[model samples]
Target: MRRQHLAEEIEEIFRCSGGTYGSPKVFIELVRRGRRVSVNTVAKVMAELRPAGRKVRRRRSLTRPGRRPAPRISSAGTSPPRNRNSSGQAT
Candidate 1:
């Protein structure tokens, strides 16, 4: 009866926050509205609702390795010394 009403209100709050508000924020909102609710209860309700937030995309690497293998420096001094370009490619 009363529990069902509280669950509905929690669901509403979760939805109103663009589905980004987790249990802590939801619990705070409920408390601010003079609702006496436990954090655990809010967490439980949120788990049941399963509202999803936006997924964070990982930043792409700007300096990926080139297809060419790096030229090895020879200790035997057989090969002529090579100048390296800004991209670490042998010139």
Candidate 2:
């Protein structure tokens, strides 16, 4: 049996959270409020109405060392000692 206008009320819940609502949580909340909604339906709504402020991280390409050492900003200041010191200790 259709509740006739449950989607509208549920939609408000999703909107109130700024579109960050997921189906399972929404389902639980609806159940708490004595409203019945299929989890699958909620998931479908989220897939259709994805919220804002969501981001995915992109994978980075691997780097290979060339004949020369890589130029890193970590050594920007404090020049190496004039002596060819392998150990940090001064001779």
Q: lDDT by residue for model 1 over 11-63, one digit each (tens)?
A: 89878988877788889999999999899988887778776555557999867
Q: Pick the candidate with the highest TM-score.
A: 1
**RMSD values, in order shown:** 10.8, 11.2
Error of 2 at 76 (Å): 25
Q: How badly does each model clash, as a count of residue pairs?
A: 0, 0
TM-score of each model, paired residue for residue: 0.56, 0.44
lDDT, candidate 2, 10-90, per-residue tens: 677777767666677777778888976788876666566653323446977576556567576676667885664687666
Q: What's the lDDT of the predicted structure labeled candidate 2? A: 0.66
* TM-score between candidate 1 and the true structure: 0.56
